[model samples]
Target: MTQFDAGTEFDRQVRTLIEKGFGELAGLSADAYADLLAPLRATVTDRAAGMEAPTEGRVPFVLVITRELAPIERAVPLLTLGGRKRKPGIIDRHYAEGDLVRFVPAKEVELPDARAYVLFDVDRGEEFCGAIPNDAMATIAGRGRTPLTMEEGIALVTQYPAALAKNKCFSLGGSRCGDRRVPAIWISENAPKLGWCWAGNPHTWLGMASAADRAGSLG
Candidate 1:
């Protein structure tokens, strides 16, 4: 994987999002979307100074737009893997639009109300691969960490597609539909896909993704 300076990575994220038509999805012009995120550039630079790149894990931080601004259904389609053509990410047919809305962040995960924020120390928890989603959530909480929500999981992949490696995919255990369904991102036909798995069932290839914490605003 290639590493970039904090400023460069931040710039790349903005450029990538705009190129993917995130602004249009959010009903804003490309220029407006870039301008809206201007305030976050300084925050990324400052926070990045004190943080060291993890030897293993996703990335130091990821820039994320909330579901309110970029709906998961729309945002997932923007993702591509292995440099292939962008494929639309899909929610399981079992879940209607209403079911998607019910899958909020777990109580242990506190998110800010701001439309955009930074998620730090993101990790596609490979160590937990094969563990039940419910058990993984408990372990993550015991370590004082929070599991990644569906939107947050998508945001990580949006910034770093390489994170969704084959045989090493991850689950968004932080978002629960008040039932057994846990959202996950994995490779499907060499493209990134958004789908779900049973919370109580263990999959050898799927780990629960998590983060150390999140910041809603730089201010």
Candidate 2:
């Protein structure tokens, strides 16, 4: 891994600095380390597709590698994870032992060249388990213990004895409730057309929670 000073601009943008034991890029050759660092050093290119310009108050991102494994050349867009057999976006798609790197996005990153936002590679056995964001947290916490459907999840948040109300929740785009444009919240308690919420990460939870607040006129 590449080495950096404690408080440099580069160090600030790194998420795995602490994890990497003071920002050391372990197990990678010097050339590979440089390849990973190049994107962070370079400016957004003119041909960069779907890249959002840096904005004030926008969440800064960092790259966290799971130690040794490098990403595959053909990166699969996360949205395409679950194919036809399982409805996409309804539930987290199950991955095989060495399928692909399953990562939770920390924020909304549309940039094709977003080297900083690459998730930890599960294929290489990175430790990503433990407290994740609200939605996935809710799901995992309720795994085998509670109802996982959209209706039940909404009830769990909205009705009396609402359990998940405190934590933010979001239904998938084509959710069972039928409205893709509008987001659901505690007050609304509406089941999505697709029947489930899959707010992928913390940043997504923030957006969904805010949208839910607005939709229910809570804000």
Candidate 3:
């Protein structure tokens, strides 16, 4: 089986996301990778490679991330625990219309709407993207969203049409999360045989061209 390190996969994902959703830079560089990794977790295990497990009930949802440029570290932050702080691995792209993906950082409870508590719910895992549950594994960064409750989160979801419409969460080997009708990927020149994914509407802010671009990008 062919195996690229978690960092490399992360680099490809970030580049694809930024390239399709926002940035136009050539791709991620060593310096830029380091910059993105400053506060996130970079596990030494295969979890960085996309093998993950189900972590639903644990308070504070964990998103175990890789630096993508460097193998020396990983990013594990807890977004569901309730705090107002945004961890480094997480980024708020912008306030664009219908472009606010729930994965982007926001205090869902701050709004008066109680039913807006829905988040894109990216899985909290480690060792690999699809690894089974391991009790000893380290949790992602702790409690960055401690300031809110579930009721408010639901309300925000109802109020923010953009975020709700764009809230397409993903999980490898998990159930399909996005609109099935939407085309889902980009062909990577670096790894041409392995077509890459560009995913979701909010993620479309990057440079992902549908009309002019090819259909290989898995958006």
Best by TM-score: 1
The TM-score of predicted model 3 comes to 0.22
Candidates arranged by TM-score, highest first: 1, 2, 3
TM-score of candidate 2 relative to the true fold? 0.25
Better of 2 and 3 by lDDT: 2
Task: Estimate, for each residue in 31-136, the C-alpha lDDT of model 3 and write its tens digit.
Answer: 5643543332243222343433212211111212211211111111111111332222221223233422212222221221111111222321222222221111
Top-scoring candidate (lDDT):
1
- Candidate 2 Cα errors over 4 Å, as ranges: 1-7, 14-35, 44-58, 63-111, 114-219
Residues 14-94, candidate 1, lDDT per residue (tens digit)?
998888788898899988999888788887888776566544356888888888889887888888764664666655566
> Which scores greater on TM-score, model 1 or model 2?
1
lDDT per model vs. reference: 0.82, 0.25, 0.23
**TM-scores for every candidate against the unseen true structure:** 0.91, 0.25, 0.22
